[model samples]
Target: MLIDASSVAASADEIRAGAVSGIIFDMDGTIIDSMPSHAQSWVAFVQNHGIDIDVPDLMRRTTGRTGAECMRELFARDMSDEEAWQHIAEKEQLYRELFAPIFTEVAGFKAFAAQTRARGLKVGVGTAGDRHNIAFAFGHLKLPTPPDAVAGGDEGLAGKPEPAIFLEVARRMAVPPERCIVFEDAPFGIEAARRAGMRAVAICTSHDAAQLAGPHVLAAARNYHELIESKFLERLHVEPA
Candidate 1:
């Protein structure tokens, strides 16, 4: 059944007692501190291409979107399809270089993921990024395995607020949408979870907690530690590792 916020809040106690089986995580803002790196790369790419848009403006249009989708918005009417693709690829390559050294697991995220896996709950990734970004997330984080399944932009899934990527992750994990939970930092990602018929927890790794507020979000935490300590997972009925 679709549980409301208060019901979900109360259910955390039940979850601690034992209800959910899997988690779907968004890679960039939710799992790692990579959004700024992405923004910088985007600004440089647009500037180099002689396009003119600022960071805040870009953030609105770009955050939670695949590089290709962002390229479409920025280049759609202005450039040829091939040129748009090329620009997006070039921008992402630059992002990889910039993000390589700085890419590190979000606070408490690695431990939380290990804990979730140890409890036998499935893990899956849903991101609007490309394969290269996926590689960076796993490689940089040193995860033993690429998440059991991943939905990326190149896979042709619709982007955030569309529900396709999260739905795909649910399918790959063999979990029903209603029984799964999503962790995200974007408003769009939260909406995507709701659209997919899943509950979500928002993290304030990028945006402020107030900005990410929504009915679909069961709780919002500043970091993974806060999430774990606050009984966020336990409430979901996720067992201790």
Candidate 2:
């Protein structure tokens, strides 16, 4: 988790001009430290069902996908929404159970979020997690300030790499895509931000920064602590709160 602070700061030219007005975030790995628990739950779920599957491959294939999409991809079958929910619900419960004890935010996430808002940025969350997952996370995270808006996968929207989810969040925040910056951890989430005409900050939690990088990526850091140390918000010239 050794992030190059200078390189991270030098890429913030887009933010330095006070052009960005909104910040959208991806949840699981980007905000909460839940990816490892999600992975473990996937393994246990497969084992409990006596299914033979490569957990790592499954993670890569479905990490940023919607619940229905994950079910369809995992089984290679076209499932009705009802069927998908039935299956995914059980797995999600397992994830919640496994993650509850270890529920924690990425280092410095709360402070950074407060700082971002204090600098006059509207914060929102656009995550592939379903409503239940969102509720579960928020219940545990108890963030000092909740996001101004949140769009989840259960909204019948396509997930990451499609840009629909992030676009929906931006629409809710009333911020033009070009004026919003997405904070994401997965490659698909980063690509979704790019497709949505938004720039992004890569959170190197579940994947390597290289895997998440793109022309629209403004910064990459291991956690909010690194971003704070690098003066990420301080460098951004934003409106007075």
Candidate 3:
């Protein structure tokens, strides 16, 4: 069932039951501030391919999709799947190099994640980044658990706005989809959470506060700290009597 206000109300009962064991996080804009790095990589990669595209426009296209999907959209010309994959791989390699230096977390992200684990929540990463990007993120972030589970863009799972990736993460974590809480930064990711029957809190790291407001998100915050402070975490519990 898709997550709606009524569904979220129902899920709160599960959270208080301690049946909700998992926390799913989006990698790029939600966990780390890497969206700009991706935008830069797309601009440079496309330029090298003799295609001059606006970085912002390219970023919008690629926000919650796999690199191959972005390439297909940008090329506009028909390409065999293999050719598209090859081009995306090259572009992602460039993105890795560009993002290596600034592998910083969103404000309070590491602490909040650690705390969530301390509270006995299974932490999972659900991302549209491919294997290489996932590896790069872990290597740079250097966390304790390295995510209890991960679902990547190339994992044969459907990409964001489809809910497959998040649902897969919950499945891998042995948690039910309705019990998973998704932390996302993109509009597509929010829609995915709703489709997966999970409540989503938007982390507005890349977008302005006004831009992040929408129906798909239960709540919106500027960063991890704000999310925690706003008591959106209470959504993880049943409404007090």
Candidate 4:
């Protein structure tokens, strides 16, 4: 991984030489600090419903799954899409209410995304979050501009740990998967990037670096600020496309 100056510099050189043209960010923990709120919402949702489920374990299991996938996994049963979304909407509404007052991006996330665009790298979001959650995050984040492309969970793609979501983002960006870099905060996302044949940079917002580590991971940082400190952006030599 790009943990030191030389390695970070080398990876930048490799990136430039590799002609990496697109960067896909996982929405929840990578772009915004929403994981904690998600966890809290789950606890509240279950408590309200008088369910005896293990919330933390549920979070661990469902972190990178689609809402329907999460619901099915949570209850360990197959569910119609309409039935799944009904539950998902209720839980996510709780999440939005809990998160709205405290919404914040990972440190330097906006600046990092802006820098990528300035360097001519297309920025996209590949997220397990559904469309409503996407709107919720953006309504609060207020990025300087929207991503070049976005692939949300509600679109029927299999979620992280599956390459479909990230691959779709690459397709929408009109960039080959091998020419994209995925910024992710979960182990499932790192694996998804690998499956998509894209390089990965782990944003360790919730999980430990060890949990997110993989051969495909070029770097792991607590936030974009650390990546900036590593001078990663400065070494990128991509020009406007």
Query: Which candidate has the highest TM-score of all?
Result: 2
Backbone clashes, each candidate: 2, 0, 0, 0
- For model 1, the stretches where C-alpha displacement exceeds 4 angstroms are 1-18, 76-82, 238-241
Off by over 4 Å in 3: 1-19, 214-216, 238-241
Relative to the unseen true structure, what is the C-alpha lDDT of residue 69 in candidate 3, on a scale of 0 to 100?
Answer: 73
Candidate 2, pairs of clashing residues? none
Q: What are the lDDT scores of the predictions, listed in order?
A: 0.78, 0.88, 0.76, 0.87
10 residues in a row with least lDDT, candidate 1? 1-10
lDDT of 1 by residue, 40-110 (tens): 88788878889877767867766777666788787656665467667778998988888898876778899
What TM-scores do the predictions have?
A: 0.88, 0.95, 0.86, 0.93
| Residue pairs in collision within model 3 | none
What local lDDT score does residue 99 receive in model 1, on the 0 to 100 scale? Answer: 88
By lDDT, who's the top model here? 2
Which candidate, 2 or 3, has the higher TM-score? 2
lDDT of 1: 0.78
**Candidate 4, residues 51-154: lDDT per residue as tens digits?**
88989889888888899999898778899999999999999999999999989999999988888887789999999999999998988889888999999999
What is the per-residue lDDT of model 2 for residues 1-241, given as tens digits with 9 covering 90 to 100?
A: 3376555665456557547789999999999999999999898888887889999998888888899999888788899999998888999999999999888999889889998998899999999999999999898889878899999998999988899999999999988888888999998899899999998999998988789878788889999988888788877756432
Model 1 pairs whose backbones collide: 12-235, 15-237
lDDT of 2: 0.88
